[model samples]
Target chain A: MAELDLDSADGRREALRRMVTIRAFDQEAGNRFADGEIPGFVHLYIGEEAVGVGTCASLESDDYIASTHRGHGHCIAKGLDPKYMMAELYGKAEGYCNGKGGSMHIADVDAGMLGANGIVGAGPPLATGAALSIDYQDRDQVAVGFLGDGAVAQGQVHEAINLASTWDLPAIFVVENNHYGEGTPVEKQHNLDNLSDTAQAYDIPGVTVDGMDITAVAEAVAEARERARAGDGPTMVEAQTYRYRGHYEGDEEPYRDDEEVERWRDQDPIESFKDRLIERGELTQEEFDDLRAEIEASIDDAVEYAQETDAPEPSAAYEDMFVEQPPELERFANVARTDGGANGGDHR
Target chain B: MTAQAELEQETETMTVREAIRQGLREELERDEDVYLIGEDVGVFGGVLEVTGGLYEEFGEERVRDTPISEAGFMGAATGAAATGTRPVVELMFSDFMGVSMEQIMNQMAKMHYMFGGKAELPVTVRTTEGGGMGAASQHSGTVHTWIAHFPGLKAVAPGTAASAKGLTKAAIRSNDPVFVFENKMIYEQSGEVPTDEDYTVPIGEAAVEREGEDVTVVATQRLVGESLGVADSLEGDVSVEVIDPRSLYPLDTDTIVESVEKTGRLVVADESPLSYGTHAEIATRVQEEAFFSLDAPIQRVGTPDTHMPFSPPLEQEVLPGDDDVRAAIERIA
Candidate 1:
């Protein structure tokens, strides 16, 4: 696996492009959901792109990551093709999960993206387990579990961190504290102000970083990844981020005011990162516009591909239930395979 | 000699505990990715001593002990299985499944299907169940029915030491997640286990412990042995056939349905509760396939829908045994 060279101009440009791509992909997803083109609800990662891109920028090609429900940004950051992810969201056969998993459960294990889980706090344990596998296999790789602020209160998340710490497994936990866990505020959800403080209980290093700043998040995760690889166990890095969009696409968002959303929008991650790159002479304004245009076109192509793809056949429901599909399912499989209510059909 | 006869000739007489331990040891030796993780599974040789001497032989890395955190380790095992490794995790008691229910139901069981078949979880969860040693309600409850009923999980409850070794090996080798439900009381019961390391009893197959024409007794776990005993005693009068449907989920319905067709009378016996349990599932499948073959109404032999009491008499009274099997057989046969 090649070392992540985020400090290099090429690496920085690539990181910014990924963040922009995430924003464009999610923006398209939000519009599609509102237009009723996409079937299910979508939690846009529009505002929290930096957290995913920065944290993932610290990881090598073979390192694993388990993501939460708002997982499009992480999927993009982890190098999953936007076309396949969009196809999954569109419930098409060409999707990552073959239409079985929609917006919430897109996964590409071969790409080292474990999954975008629907169940909150579920990814941490999975990430820890992946770390266990890495340790057991004697691999020089680490695992990262990305969770939300709401997941901080979950007992299983703490259990995962504790287990990872105890085993000295190469795992890094980056808490994407996007202020609200669903609709509730972080303050009400947790007693501790800083979610990273929860790491102290496990006797591991804990730090908080500016999630809006990609560089800050990247540096923090890179350090944590180093510690993990050096057999220093797990580290908790809380990224103080905010989501500009509603919890879900159609959410009325009765919990928070418009003023808070506007305030968060003021510190837009992509805009600030683009400005930082221009200021650093790493990127020109014209170059940034070209990058944005290129990303927008790719997103447009992904949406088109997803729209053109076919829905999985009805019988596909029985497939992939087990490596060797069980005989008990065969009775039902026959019914599904039959065209109409002639061959022992309409039993219900 | 033929392969079957050759394999049979090299049999070793061992208890169920020893059979399971031998299976674990063979798998650990066979696959570098295979590891044992659970409470008291290492230095203490397992809580029930089922994994006795494994820790010494395999060392701490392969035979690892963990804190009594069921959800953590269970979730970790699921993750590890998905990443690449076969983790045979023990939950100490079947009752402890509640603590890790989220991981089992949401993560471990559904990962493959939910991920559109991209992920393969080669995880085996081994736990103890059944009532006999006065362990009371929590520890001794027969919960194999729950795991069997759960989607994406294959369950096996062995009735003999041979099936115990075979099923344990099969579960560990399986690419999908499997649960081996061991009856705590049967660990001491000795039987002939094939000495071959590669020997495995395929999942979704049943073994006809005894063959008869009068009635068919479909049983699981300790009840399989009990039904066999009842079949032996009622050889002349009832001629009871005992069929151990070891794998509960992908059940060998053909074997069970054939036995019911031959016998014409059915008695489903399991240590789980009578209603909405393993008995109901087996009964439903049998009646569905061999409805016309039944000469009489099917009878069920299992614990009444209640928890096992602490008292010896109450515990024994609530627990189903050979007497229950015989009575159920007499009613239908």
Candidate 2:
């Protein structure tokens, strides 16, 4: 309930708690997805927890962030309740999107977390646009766009960064280069060695940090936020991290060997951070265990709440398409309401 | 006042281009949150001159220009609209929508719905369409069908100067994302537009340009005027009725159905391609709503499934006009 102070020991403990919370939530989601409890595909953020938590730690609650398909960690880091996110994954009426947007599209706009985009490389433009809004209104705020390594190859990303730089808008482009974009390695996708080198093309400052180190990611974002607030335009930060799991729960990752995965796991962000905290006499092994247990229990409560929540009514599908339902959609809504959408099976 | 403004009030005769400019100027003055952003929209005063003199009035902050990046500006406008600002993005040409289709289809259209109706996108995308002036394939293609077919977005194509002014204002004020597809050929065409700043033609309503008893011709955009001309030439021979379905997506099916039920014969005309396009949607809705009242089969007048050619003769050869509407009416009536 206390305001976060990233500079203090207590704030570092809270950060560790958030990272653990993300890991537990995604772990449970992956297990349930494999067990057929969660429908649709889910892109887990198990290994990239520190990047999300640390990057968000550098931001104020009013600062905007646009996330990608791999967005659970970002949502959790942005302070969205886990119960509602779990309900969304379960396709329940109590979900963040009221069962409309499942895992990939979770959003809490009032919290300044733009909806997680389904389209790759789509977040940069939105974040840049948000920065444009900030500049237009003469507000002292920043907007950060969190994108994947694969998104760097997208044209819209280039346009977004160019526009942001040209206007000197207060926006930051944070690239989570997790070694691979889906099954393809990052090397195969981009000609450049360092993804942050992309900032050079737009005449903006760029930096690469150890994404596994929470402090490094936080420091880079903090500097970027500072420059942005000073009206120095955008900065690109590439967090070199890894995803421990496959791209999705059901992905059969034939691209990399087990040894490559083991090498990355050896530098696991959460475990390393916890070890450092204990060495500093700020935490003990028992305290860490208790923290993990507490987070696991909370995730369990989220799952139970999701299971008890009811599915949205069939007519709910046609409800959010517009602010006021026009006469044009009445015929389709009529059929969906009567047949429970069975007649329009092709639509799904 | 200038000659254009004098003409607007004296004879109430305002060109479509002038009417649209007036609407933008009024909205920009009414709401500080409303802005105009696009390529050449600031100092250049729009490539087609639709936004002329706006840059001088509103300045660069409001009438902002971009570096010819459609996807970036379109998505930025979408994001700006999601926030507190209302952005009216000029896409230059409808044919260029393919460059930014990802932002249009995935982000701009689906954000509000996917976000469980939490976000409101008061964004208006104004683009020009229609084949004329020898602008060739890229600049002259009519792509309103694509916007109309896509859900979570509204499409409006005005046929007259009055509807152009009214619909542009209405689209700017709507909470949902709206696309104003202006036919390039009709920009210079003049008509009597209401001088009242508050006068706005409601979206999703059909205007019976001229009513008759024997046959109904439902048309859109450039074809609306051509069909009206054909109806006039027919005089007493067929008693042809001409209707303009200004809004394409939430199409005025009731008005079309009523006209069809009374006339007993129908002809659907639009500038889009014949297959699975605007003509098909209008014809389908008419048959579904007024099937029993029809005495004759519905006829469709549209471009044969082909791209607009570069040659002026070839372009004219494929373009639908008053002759096509008259021929279709003759066959059905």
In DockQ terms, which candidate is top? 1
Kindly report which residue stretches of model 1 are placed more than 4 angstroms away from their true locations once superposed. Answer: A1-4, A336-348, B1-7
The backbone clash count of each candidate, in order, is 0, 0
CA RMSD for every model?
2.2, 3.8
How does each model score on lDDT?
Answer: 0.90, 0.89
List model 1 lDDT by residue over B117-172, tens digit each: 99999999999998888888888888888888888999999988989998999999
Compose the digit string of candidate 2's lDDT tens values, residues A49-168: 989999998888888889999999999988999999999999999999998899999998888889898899999999998998898998978999999999999999999999999999
B-chain TM-score for every candidate? 0.97, 0.96
Best by TM-score: 1
Candidate 2 scores a chain A TM-score of 0.95
lDDT of 1: 0.90
Model 2: per-residue Cα lDDT over B1-333, one tens digit each = 111332354337789999999999999998898999999999999999999999999899999999889999998988888777899999999999999999999998999888888988999999999897788888889999999999999999999888898899999999999999999999998888887877676778778888789999988888878887898899989898888888997888778888888998999899899998898888877776677778989999888988888898998999989899999999977
lDDT for position A147 in model 2: 96
**Least accurate stretch of 10 residues (summed lDDT) in model 2 chain B?**
B1-10
